[model samples]
Target: MAMAVGVVAAPLGLSVISLVNRLQDIFSRVGSHSSIDLPQVAVVGSQSNGKSSVLEALVGRDFLPRGNDICTRRSLVLQLVQIKPSQDEFGEFLHLPGRKFHDFS
Candidate 1:
């Protein structure tokens, strides 16, 4: 259930938040921070079991594409990123380049 994931994710989330804070602190001291490549955590769960709904709620928008019931369509690598000038990306896949995926909701 979601509670299990929450229990496991809470610590990981805190650790990641602390790491980002430390990175920001370090960059601020450097006077000029060009950019940063942040790591991502994959949230794997049963298809259409409210996983997308949960993510959509967290993001406060419906950017992720939906798909048919019988097919996976696309494997999304969900990355929490800042939409700044330097960091301008929602997600990217390792196996594909310049290929953005979409699904039918």
Candidate 2:
């Protein structure tokens, strides 16, 4: 499904993230068995170094679990898209398509 999102033009033109997001949408629509490799961003650092905190700040949400110890044991792929200010912000999971998660907490 195509989402009605707001597009912010970059100062110098289209950014790499915009291109990758477009490519990802195309590949996802094609199917799961497509053998195309898309560029990805990996957050690697020492343990308890605020990796999850950085991601949460970027997405402007506090959905990721945080504590004094390690809370995430599995890899997570997050797709962030810009939305219109008038529209309510929400999140969707690749495994559970069509369901809009309004609450991040």
Candidate 3:
């Protein structure tokens, strides 16, 4: 699956590496370099299929609904973020590919 996503993104001058978002988009010229926002990926599988285990391991959290016959009904956002310095404070930012930026510091 990882290889498949890499193949699909390669032809478009993109790579499948998990780079941290460094530059925040403000306003830019028409021909400026733009970022592409990858959609939030979710795991869709049957119950007891180890989906939760995978997610938990990735995020280092036990976010999977664990129980007998448990199934996830709603989508989950397992975002990776970075910390930043601010005036007399610190902040956090959501890591997206190249679209919208959200500040939940």
Q: Any residue pairs clashing in model 3, and if so which?
A: 35-98, 36-98, 37-98
- Candidate 2, 1-105: lDDT as tens digits: 564579655643236667777778777787665566776667878888888888888777898877777898677888777666899988787779899888756
Candidate 3 at residue 4, lDDT? 56
In terms of lDDT, the best-performing candidate is 2
* True lDDT of residue 68, candidate 2: 79
Question: What number of backbone clashes does candidate 2 have, counting pairs of residues 3 or more apart or in separate chains?
Answer: 0
At residue 10, give the lDDT of candidate 1: 44
> How far in Å is the alpha carbon of 71 misplaced in model 2?
3.5
lDDT of 3 at 36: 59
TM-score of each: 0.37, 0.61, 0.37
Tens-place lDDT per residue, model 1, 71-93, is: 44465544454445874345445
Which residue ranges in model 2 land beyond 4 Å of their true spot?
Answer: 1-18, 28-39, 67-70
Q: What is the C-alpha RMSD of each candidate to the true structure, in Å?
A: 14.1, 6.8, 13.0
* Candidate order by decreasing lDDT: 2, 1, 3
Of candidate 2, the 10-residue stretch with the lowest lDDT total is: 8-17
